[model samples]
Target: MPSPTAFQPVATAMPDNVRILSFEVGHGECTLVEFISERQVAFRCLLDAGRVLPAALLDHLKSNPRPESPDLDVVVLSHVDNDHQGGLPGLLEAGISFREYLSPCLPAFKRLRWLFGERVNRAVDRAFAFEQQLRSHKVAVQYPLEGFKSRYASSRVTLSIISPAARLIKTLASGSPERVSALVSNSPTPLQWLFEVDEPVNEDSQALAAVFDGRVTVCPEDFDTFLPGPPGPPASSLAQQHSQGDPDFFGNATLNDTSLIVVLDILLDGVHRKRLLFPGDQENWTYVAAQHPAGLGIDVMKAPHHGGRVYLRDKDEDLPGVYAWLRPKTVIVSANGQYDLPRASFRDVLRTVGGSLLCAHQRTFEALSAGAMKQPTATSCFQSMGCDRGRGRSVTVTLTADSESADLPACVQGSGITGLAPIVVLRQDVTVPSEGLLRYTYGELDRHATWIKDRLDEARREFLNKLKKTRTAFDAITEQPLTSWRVLAALAKADGRHDLVADPDPVLKFARSQHVFWCAPVTGYRASPESFASLPAAADFNAARRWLKSIPSLLLIVESGNRFPTGTARVEILQHADWGVFDHLLAGKLKHPAPVIADEVRPVLLPLIAADYSFRLCHFNYPDSHYDGGKAFLLLQRDSVVIPDLLSPEWQVAWDWHAHGSPFKAPWKILAKLASEQMLAGTYLQTPYGRDALFNRFKPSTTTPLPAAMHKARWVTY
Candidate 1:
């Protein structure tokens, strides 16, 4: 949350010929490739839609004037992996059409299993469904088989299928039901599927090559299996030493090895200018090097398998996965913490080889903070290499046939060690505070702070005015409500204020006053078993210790009876910090040490409200309503918890909460909203009162050289 010492605005240098946008789709893959000619879009190709479509891509499609016609020139489903092709259905649903749809065909039985009520692979199911939909729309669908070629007249671009040799397709057509059943029986988890050595569907993935002018880019959609024949005549390239590995390879290849290996090259007068490679989740580098020696030593490469490490034969013999002997200058990882991807080994290898990294998702930072990855270096690798965990951030790589170098954003460039892209704040400028307390520093943001304070005042005044103007009534109808009464009893036990059980009206009065409404839990009607289903039964409390791990402060209310006569109720409040003593009590899991007296229901009512939970109560004045007098209405609202740690990833979460108007204290949500608006307007860094104002309010300080735990959680300024 710092700006560069000196702001030097530089226009993004995009190549005229080709542009690639690798989306941040959270452990999925979705890329858009645009072929531009004379500043006009000659063709648009979508490479491997991710598990979900990125909003940017959807917006791009919707922006097309020709909704009735094909807006996209090509859609390449790298393989049937759900992460790669799941978004295709969404694209089809959006009414976006493409002239050509290239993918490997699933075996007939595999595609038809869904119809017979069998649990088919989700990837296969989606692919088959999409194919049917495309055919219905009169779109041309073709398998990207080896030696298959197509030429586009308008773009003068030639397309060629360079992978999944005809033999591999035939092997797939002869379904491996026995192998599939064995794998299914093994019950490999989703994460295990990525490393499974014998995932047949991935073996049949397509690798596509595109040629326009003097530039060529190959997209291998997870096609990493090496057959016993020549794929085709290898293209010409520089003779370079392949990455070294054990020559005697004996282990089965991972599903990652099935990744489509694709290369990008620029040539003028048959002279190689630039060479880049994009190995899709591939880990078997020894075989790829032996097969395609011409495309070694890439200038840029998207680290395969979301930057996962590869085990050659055994876990002890693990190697950095994406290195695969084809080291590149810049490595981009498109993944998140969901799968614990973009591993630390990837970072160590990059540092050793002097390569830069660009991470697309912020959750990667969370993984680092959670100790899922470890790095032992002087300065943080995330800072030096450049990372963008910013909201909706994506990495764009542009290449031109004329230039020998590909263009990357300044933040993620390979040339210099410029810490972060355009932000640099000295660590000495920060202030660290004790836990659970936040210190806000205004500095240059005095005016903004004052404005915010005034806005808070105005908002409070407005709320009071609305309260005075509205006619509201509360009827606590607590008759025949045993479940809710049990829940309230559990809540009382959890708060360690069981004395309130005998007199619960004080809690109701406190709730009606709205002083603690900021953190109070809001219920639609009344707390019920169905509403809090995850809560264990109160009788199971002692046995459900694991479920009591982390419980938030809450308010429980039981309302019952008819509307005409008003309602009767009982209310209780529970509060805890760090560790909750009776977290599982409300789940109906509390174990009583002694037997209870069935007929001893002494539910006393209190006239006075506790000072900790309530403020002065105000009466509602309604001239038109008959039920507006004396009846106290229990109005509960949800509030955002204040996160005192600036380095914590919760700042991003708080930002998101503020987006949908999650109720929070005045200045907190207001600051978030203002920061978001400024960022969207492209003025967060340009103005005097920039986003630093918002961050300053939440900023917690640490030492100059942040410890491992703090480093991962926070991005340092300088």
Candidate 2:
């Protein structure tokens, strides 16, 4: 008991230095982090390739000395959106091989297919190509889920995924394609013309615009109208003006919401540590703030969404629950003059909160370091704060294990704080349990089983209810009266029985004559008299009979019901020895066409009408029928086919006709009815000619491409 042997903590070795380089890629983002040990770079990580790699960054990497295996330790794509990943292909093409590639879209090819369907094929194709290139280059690819953590650079640097939440990714993966598309296309509500006033003019607009990296000029009057009756103590004129703009004033929410947020913990020298936040382009700051509220104070934070005002609008106050939790010493904005980024109002808020602001741009870098060693004068607003713009638009801060304050570049040191106190570095050693490590108690297993059973029972009840409704609907339709020959003829045409109507036989002639006046008003009805007129006596009656035999059961029912009455005569005709050859055809089981009988056609017709089922008959014309029997009888089984919901009320009356005769008055009416129904259904009635007839019937109108000027204008507005 070596009161002697007092407990002694083990000492851990740490890297000598950590450096971050935020590249000045115009209107995009690319950051490089290097871990140094023994005054030599041990590991390198590239956050994004931006829209394009800056020449300076590329030149630096190309010229820098490298180890035998000169490879990037990590290359994170963040999300699949263009801006974040556009330069990656070029980087790879430039021969920058990486050890690991992390992105949310890498393992989501199936989800991408489901989300985009075929609409965004080009985007999906590029994503797939990127993945293939990575694999071909032997890069390890991973789709990091929330809470994923990894140690790199010999365990001196640790990175943890803060977002997106697992549930959000699952929702996107499992959601309907249409819903996902809608979400991707989500945009701010269009401003009403009534509320859209002319842009305002201000004396400081140009200066403010330049200060914001020349993104957008401030127009105070543009937002003045949106101000409340009286401003609260914390709500300044700037706050009201900023709040007047759209929530998505900086960028759309779709891609921004999927951003990969990470927290990096770097051991500077054993006991001293530094925390850096790289929140890709995450727009949902509230979620991040809520998830990591405490122990998240960091030395540096890359301002999210390119320092857009959406995250920090109120100059007099900090963002709700965010600023207090983070308390970042310095904020870096990686944006150039494009789409009005690095909002001036946000910079003002950052200054109000006593946090240093740095822009990843050449102009801002030069401005900050213009008089690095000089004292503040009346003309220099920024000089009061000892601002040190690190060399080459890159800021570097270092902390030593024994030092109480951070050692930063002379450009980054503000006048008030010559040195920064070491921030509390929170480390979470998350021991992810393996599959075998998961040991569920019996109670948990039982609870899971009960939940699954309840779900199955609910599904069963729903399915049974649906089945009951279907059966009831079927029964109700079956009890209706058998449709007359004329109505059946019309429905047969409507249900795609053009050949049945084309047949120039005696039974059809008899039915047509009986309903001559009855056929006039039927819409989509055409009496194909030309077919009969052109027919020669020797024309293929065998072919016609074969065609009749091949018709489907629903059509056969219509034909038979119209050709013969529901009586012993019909049964006798069907049971005739000559009709035996057509029995299989009537049962909808005919695989090949049988030889047609030239004289025993009546026997073939009997099988169609002998069945006891309700039918609706109408007189209509099949415009595209090869055989034009001027007016033909069409038959419809009440329950077999789905009627177009948008058909005219008159068509419904015609369908429900019980007058034992035709209910139509004109041939054009038939055409109109059929055209309207087909248009509404967006498909053609199935026929031997297939979808060609439907296409011919309802071809979309040709649209002329817009002029270049008009197209450009439309897209600008969009």
Candidate 3:
């Protein structure tokens, strides 16, 4: 094992629901959504009609395919910017197709779409992929409607339109830029959630909200306004055909102002589901902010126009700034890294949202700071490549439901938590196979027959000894209120399941008995055994149950970390029952009734605890990459209120990094090691590392920690 460092990359996989597959293009990119149903299918939200999809994206999608044959569902065309949809033509070339076409229904973009109208589509008739395949399969877009309540293999997904409201459109076209500015100026950040009065662009941009499993995510493409172009010459008569209601386009109906906005309330069997709001550059959040609906607390948000300062009023700088309402746990700002999102504006938004900020292309140095993307860098993921390099007006987000919590990193390298108490399960199950000493060497079987027989005999004896345990084991429950005496007594008589080690047959029998829905990963997360380390474990309802059963043994007991850039402690004990509760365990999951816990008899509990660890560390240091910068405590646990200077003095990054750029952090490795050791032990360890120092100082905790020390100091009213 190598020394853990913040720069060490953690492995991340796409969620099971839908994977957002984006490809690098010239100046933009293309992203496709896939739904895991009876088969794996791509949701074609965009199509070039006959042009190319980004080469990178197309290649990745083809090579990394879904398990079941997936079909394309909804096709989206977010306003016809050439860079945005340059790959629409590629879907056909790739031999992939979908059913619906999500057009902006905008008159401006409509002109370009008209080029592919009935006659044009017929003329280019070399059997365009998406539409042609859809018709053949008896599936057709035909026209746009209200919304779709789509479900694939137990993972439910939905998309709601929240922009282009009638009233806002009328106002934008009839007002001056200043008037539009005034209206948008006071609007809350996460324009989709802010509502009171109306802003022009927020009203027009097509805000599309997506719900995966139970989490809410809204991608308001460029909700923040930064009016481009000097007011174009007044539209001609033909362009003005529909100007009866309003005259000036920017004044009355700024294209950016005509977006759609919506919030989702997803639930199954009456259980409230996760929430998400999509505000398509609606200048102002009209309905969301006012209601503060469950979905407004979206977990993932795409920065409006890559955090353009124009969307925010000049005054917010003095206050909070644009990251107010759309405080996504993970915010992906798609912009040309070198341009857009001024440094000042970026900092302002950080202070406002107080969540992780993922700026594209490392545009501003601030993007790399802990206050922004603070978590350990994730590069092993196939997706992270070129992810930071967002193409102009090209960003894709996919919401999937399989194992909703951001999939645990394939391997957590620098998490500062590992090697806890001797793991009982690991010790018992692990096996070290011997080198090839088979019977057949040169025509091996006969040559090494004696050696092979001896090895087999030894293997059988070891296996038998390991399984010869009768002291403690699992058994069937024949009573109720599992915590009661009746069930406890019967537990002893039942036989410990010997088959649970490999076969899920026993687990499935338990699940069906409880009437629980066995919703497992269908496509994206690679639920099939063929995907794991050649595990060859059969994948099905039963297999999923078995995997769920082993979670208690597999999960690490460290404070949960996030993909978001926050130093707050999101700790969790995977053994608790909450682990299998789908997206409900995610902080961003809406306040829906938690899904029914898995079998009460063989009950499991996965409690994720959010704690404040700053009290323990209470210091900071400047990052070596940003050498001289001061380091204050960058992390604060959720729900924790951190007082300033709880420690003897203001902290900086690691002391070594400040004194010597990168090489001097030698001591840092030691400190990090100590931290990892304590974290791995969770809270149950005796004589823990940092615990002693903190316990002696602040003595703060949930119950009997400490009382504030009284001190006298002269107050100066500067």
Best by TM-score: 2
Q: Lowest-scoring 10 consecutive residues by lDDT in candidate 3? A: 473-482
Off by over 4 Å in 2: 1-15, 106-125, 177-252, 310-321, 362-718
The CA lDDT of each predicted structure is: 0.40, 0.45, 0.32
Q: Give per-model TM-scores.
A: 0.40, 0.42, 0.35
Candidate 3 residues 1-718, lDDT tens each? 6667547778764333444333334333244444433334433233222135656555555675654544355555433333444456566567764555554433222222221223222322332343344455554432222233344334455666554443333333233444434443232322321222222232233231111111222111212232232242233331244332222221222333444343333432233354544443334333322223222576554444334443322122221322444555554444343333323344334434455443324321223323243222522111222234433323344444422332222111111223575443211222121111110011211212222223333433453354346331111010001122122223323434223223433332332332222222235664321110001112222333443332221111122232212342223222221222122121011111122223221133222222212222121121112212122112212233323222222212212122223211122222223332221112211113333333443344555422231011111110
1 or 2: which has the higher lDDT? 2
Worst 10-residue lDDT window for candidate 2 reads 709-718
Instruction: Give me candidate 3's TM-score against the actual structure.
Output: 0.35
* Candidate 2 displacement at residue 306 in angstroms: 0.8
Question: Candidate 2 residues 537-630, lDDT tens each?
Answer: 1223344445543333222112222333334343443332233213222211211112112122334444554553233322223323322222
Error of 1 at 598 (Å): 96
lDDT at 432 for candidate 3?
A: 29
- For lDDT, the strongest prediction is 2
lDDT of 2: 0.45
